[model samples]
Target: MPSPNALRRGRRLSSALALGITAIVATTPAATAGSDGRFGWPLQPRPAVLRHFDKPAQNWLPGHRGVDLAGAEGQTVLAAGDGIVVFAGTVADKPVVSIEHPGGLRTTYEPVRAEIPVGRRVGRGTRIGTLESGHPGCATACLHWGARVEGDRRRNREYLDPLGLLRLTPLRLKPVRP
Candidate 1:
């Protein structure tokens, strides 16, 4: 029902749209792949998740900024990814260790006594500190893990669910049906 010229134009538009979608998918980070497991859980044995990361509607709004993993007191807390120790000190009287990874991603672990000092380069799964008890609202000792993208301004920083950084599920290949 359409003219030849209109048919060609529609095909061109569809091709351009497909190309644009492909470009976006190629550039966007794979939430589950984690770049072939570059990142991992901070707590060994994949401790139970007491609480999950809950982002606030606004940066200033109240929300759970990180996930709490049940860990035993004195348990070693490993680095989630390869990065340099940016901060290894107490935050609000609670010991914390923060690492700055590639691509401006920063991960923070609380209730951890830092074994590595600031500016030290650490690989994935490196023991950065030991977990301590007394995390608020947790019945047992837990490690609060948080992640964010470093931005120019404080409000510009975007908080992320730290769990998405790990490639826990194995990749599967599905057959394409003709």
Candidate 2:
């Protein structure tokens, strides 16, 4: 019911928006897998995702900063990439293991009993710890996997979805036809 000129203008705006989004996705390092495509799943057999990542607008805001993958208690948890163990100890009474990968990316796994020690180098899929059952909100045992960009200050750290380290399907764009 609108004029032809208005319709054309709307189409142009929509196209521009799509292109802008594509550009951002294309440039993001985490859009794909790691730089060497050596990243992998932390849990063997590809555990089901109990909860997805929900990043808050601000770092201090309340949000699920990581993902919860369904797994059995005592199940081996592997390293998603080649990295050195930075911390393998308790945090707030919960067992935790953190690894520092290349490119300043750090990965954390909570409710896990650390099998490796700090400063140990781990390759992709190396056993880092065993998943524990105390993670709240999960019906069964789950692994809370998290990733962040290591920064000098805590406020400068950028949290990322640990699943992004996996080499999933590539994003393919196709032309839309009228």
Candidate 3:
């Protein structure tokens, strides 16, 4: 049998290992995504943005971290980019799905019934889930989509504007000299 001191040391070592593994799993996508700049709108044909991302002054303060897009109830929600499903479940009575893109960015859809499972790899435009009925943020049927860069620490996680990642070409004015 191992000595008492040895047992204590073993337990500590095990705890450390567990923590390390958990951290790696949680932050793996960020490292995998790199800076490819390949992302698109989560909603196909790009639904109208009912509301834009308004970052909160502080993490816990009042702010809309994601955009609320106009969508029909039961409409399919697509993955914004290729990545693995990190989370799929309900929170505060609202169903939510989160996908982790290769560049460490995680996109989220809420008021959704997830079709994918955690750890499942998905591609851009993949059907992740369907829109549900109860998003308090929206008066009518809409999908609340949010994005954030994965961080090892809670405070370090940074929320980003999903529009910035989209590949939509901006409308430019034509030169006129009549």
Candidate 4:
């Protein structure tokens, strides 16, 4: 039988572990997307091809962490916004791409072999690399992307929903003058 103090300690430790895991998962990118409030960024993944337009539920603890896109293998990966490639290499058994914008939002693309070199600034629609999400730990074959706003804690996440930033408003032609 466990003592009362021991039980209390165990509960506290479990709580801490759960919180830590939540923080990590919330911040990390996923093959599926939600909101994109992290980097003062534009709406995510350019919701043009993929048909799913469902927004994630509001957590209230933090805004959306990153954007996600379901893609085919070896599809051309494009830049989310204008920024310099800060990280483009393999980590945790998957290819990764990281970009930092002048606005202070740090964006990352995971499960991809970035074609662009680190420190090179890329504009919107610039091809960065190919999708490498089929590897182990990246089962869904999708893009996991996230962003970090300036002056925010490293672990706090506190990101904006990428969906709002990445949404594509239909373009309307101006009225023809008589």
RMSD of each: 12.0, 15.1, 5.4, 12.1
Off by over 4 Å in 2: 1-35, 170-178
Q: What digit string (tens of lDDT, one per residue) describes model 1 on residues 1-178?
A: 9999999999999999976664454335763236678899999898889999999999899999999999999999999999999999988999999999866678999999999999999999999999999999999899999988765456567788888888667769999999
Candidate 2's residue-wise lDDT over 1-178, tens digit each? Answer: 9999999999999999976675455336854347557788889898889999999999899999889999999999999888899999999999999998765678899899999999999999999989999899988999999988755456567788777777677779999999
**How does model 1 score by TM-score?**
0.77
Q: Alpha carbon lDDT of residue 131, candidate 2?
A: 94
**Which of the numbered candidates is closest to the native, going by highest TM-score?**
1
How many steric clashes between backbone atoms does each model show?
A: 0, 0, 3, 12
Top-lDDT structure, candidate number: 1
- lDDT of candidate 4 over 116-167, digit per residue (tens): 8998988876888987656433345666666555433554334554454454
Error of 3 at 3 (Å): 26
The 10-residue segment with the lowest total lDDT in model 4 = 31-40
For model 4 the local lDDT of residue 34 reads: 25
Name the candidate, 1 or 4, with the larger TM-score value.
1
